[model samples]
Target: MTTPQQPYQAPSAEAFLMGGGGAPTAKFPAFGTTVSGRVTERPTVEQQRDIKTGDKKFWSDGNPMMQLVVTVQTDQRDTSIEDDDGRRRLFVKGQIQKVIADAVRAVGAPGLEVGGILSVTYTHDGTPSGPGMSPPKQYTAQYTAAATAMLHASDPAAASPQYAAAPPQQYAPPAPAQQQYAPAPQQYAAPPAPAPAPVAQQHNPAVAALQAQQQAQAAAAPPPF
Candidate 1:
């Protein structure tokens, strides 16, 4: 039974991007609700892989393609997230996914490794299946950046211990261009410092006084005179 109501289309890729994944605007409510934490688990990706660019892909407006099982740290005894809420998102096609992917990569997050600080603003509204069908699998509200923030904020030591931008094995310090001169460990310790040289004594006042006394005694005897 098709009713004569305005079609409620899901937001577009351009819409998400333009909004900075929902940049908290005055018109829109402040992103008071945030994800429990940064997304630690990798994104679950689906849909026809590589269907050639430029072709239009199908979008199930209400169905979520990626169900992000995110960890929320809130102790909401009165809320739905008593256990864990999957901050799922939908990707109509590979292209649209790439659009968001590129944006995320540009964010320069330290790492997406689980247990990072991931927070976002999302609405609690559910998407209904169109006219005659049952509602598709429901999901957490559309997860989006509350403001212009990264979905993955890496912990401080992430870029250091876990992975560094520099080449050599991951242990290398973070200097990109020039080699860092870090003090070597026990095995590679630097050579020990040299000892100071012994200084010579130039002013012997006691020796000079003794010589003068002997000379004065010989002169007083005056044996030659």
Candidate 2:
């Protein structure tokens, strides 16, 4: 007899992102709060709802949501690790991840490395997709100089290279010019020969004497064989 293949079930938010310590907190921080630090944990897939509707709607990854957990030490930090509290874990996606990952890359990182540091603020797109009226809010990532500046300054690495995407090729703007005509080789008259320098009169006494002396010496010198 063959055993049946079971359907995929998503882990709870408490089990989200590897279920490290416990499920994630009940809520993410308010919008626009800057969060910055190295990514303590790389991105992972977890279901959005603890209870699977059995319909794998998005990405076909079984409603697997992409999450990258980072530790923020800046004032934007919602919690403290040193104090035994959890760090702020930003769940990034298109609007937010595009902005933040771009900014992180702009700041000297080849890309968003695991250990590589990052700092970004976030806001909700206000689109909640869940069962009841008070469904969970979807958030978009935001980038700021004040928060991410240090991240740019930092040089961190990840356990393995994954998130760092290849830099886009930047070609020069093709030199904004139409077919060059080269001014048609500007031709002008040569302005006369400067009067040929007045044909300097070498018929002077000293020159004449020197010539005479040289000629006499030549006459006196024996001819070559």
Candidate 3:
């Protein structure tokens, strides 16, 4: 049986510029000044071309020159770079690449991704290598991951809490074992009380007889007097 082909979906303008398997019919102006926005397209590398001649460019080593492109939904209006839809395509190279790469590394991410927030500032111009050539532009950049950016966006209060304040549930240490103390072991039984001492019995029969005789003689003498 022959399988049916899937319908082709037209790529967005942002996708077309970011090397998303689309023809380069659209041209997006390079970022001229500082811009801040949420990333709509991930970073993509494409061959650099001459602006005037529309010919592929190469470096001194004969390798094809490459440029990194990223698309962002801008936060504010900037007529210079952003399109009518408020999306700006960042054509990153040379000094700008180093700045963005350093920022990504600082955040411990592999690279920029969709839904992330990116802010790039054109700080100043760099010293030119030759007299006739123009000076290179310098830049500084900052990035926030998608998850972190979304968290802050969804709940503004979430950003105020520090990581140290609330550790992840999985990483939290188990509660310390409850302090346990056992009562002193009870004695099996108290020692039995000492046996009472035996009492002595009077065995003086002779003294009893002498006392009876003296009492009888005194009675007889009193009657005579």
Candidate 4:
């Protein structure tokens, strides 16, 4: 009968990133929730493999993806934090998991081209060999200056002012060559006046006379007899 092997109690990537023992760790922030923590170290490939294989179990899956234990001295009210639930700090396990998944997707699997997974390792001991890079202690001044310039350029307000202040130089389109055609003379036409109404000919003069006589007689009569 084979005895069950004792579970490994190796230091967690988080613990290592937080600095072995006694050192404080940074906080990372999560979307929607008010949790902030610094990712002291990202999980390495070997570490991930071990965790999946049950060789390691540093954190519980159901817990927040972006979870980090409170530092010995974490400020819950810091402006960097999203919410102030009164805890030393907020841990967003879900957001962290998404970020990890996205990273894996981007990096893709080993031996496949494109998208590289990020890992952090303080010390190398009995860990499986894989493509990995350690965290940088400090960045170069040139890189910092370049990054700052890029951020400044990315600002809408800053970019707007630069564009507004220096409008693009206008380049007037060349005038089309004028044709040599002669000018046409202007001609005006006067409108004709309306014709007067025509008077009836004397063919009905007798009838007109009779009608005039009747009118005169009627005018001469005062009231009905």
Off by over 4 Å in 3: 1-32, 78-83, 156-225
Model 3, 224: alpha-carbon shift in Å?
99
What tens digits encode model 1's per-residue C-alpha lDDT throughout 39-63? 4234433322223783323435633
Could you give candidate 4's per-residue lDDT for residues 22-82 as a string of tens digits?
Answer: 3333333322222322222333222221426644223463321223332222234555544
What TM-score would every model get versus the actual structure? Answer: 0.24, 0.36, 0.55, 0.22
By TM-score, the better pick of 2 and 3 is 3
Among these predictions, the greatest TM-score belongs to 3
Q: For model 1, how big is the CA root-mean-square deviation?
A: 23.1
Q: After superposition, how far is residue 74 of candidate 1 from its true place, in Å?
A: 4.5
Candidate 4 residue-wise lDDT at 214: 66
Candidate 3, residue 84: the lDDT equals 51
Q: Write the per-residue lDDT of candidate 3 for residues 1-225, one digit (tens) a residue.
A: 232333354556655666443322223235456677888765677777797997767767566788877877775555553345566677788887888889888888788989988888866778999989988777889999887889787774675554335555666778889979988765555334434333331245665566556666655553321
- The worst-scoring run of ten residues by lDDT in candidate 1 lies at 22-31
In candidate 3, position 161 carries an lDDT of: 55
Candidate 1 structure, TM-score to reference = 0.24
Better of 3 and 4 by TM-score: 3
Cα lDDT tens digits for candidate 2, 1-225? 232333675554444755564423324467665556555444454433333674323444434454444443333323443343445555555455567666655655554555555556545545556666554444433333334544544534333345475789988777777876655655544333322222354657676677667667766665442
Candidate 3 lDDT at 27 equals 32
User: Where's the lowest-lDDT run of ten residues in candidate 4?
Assistant: 136-145
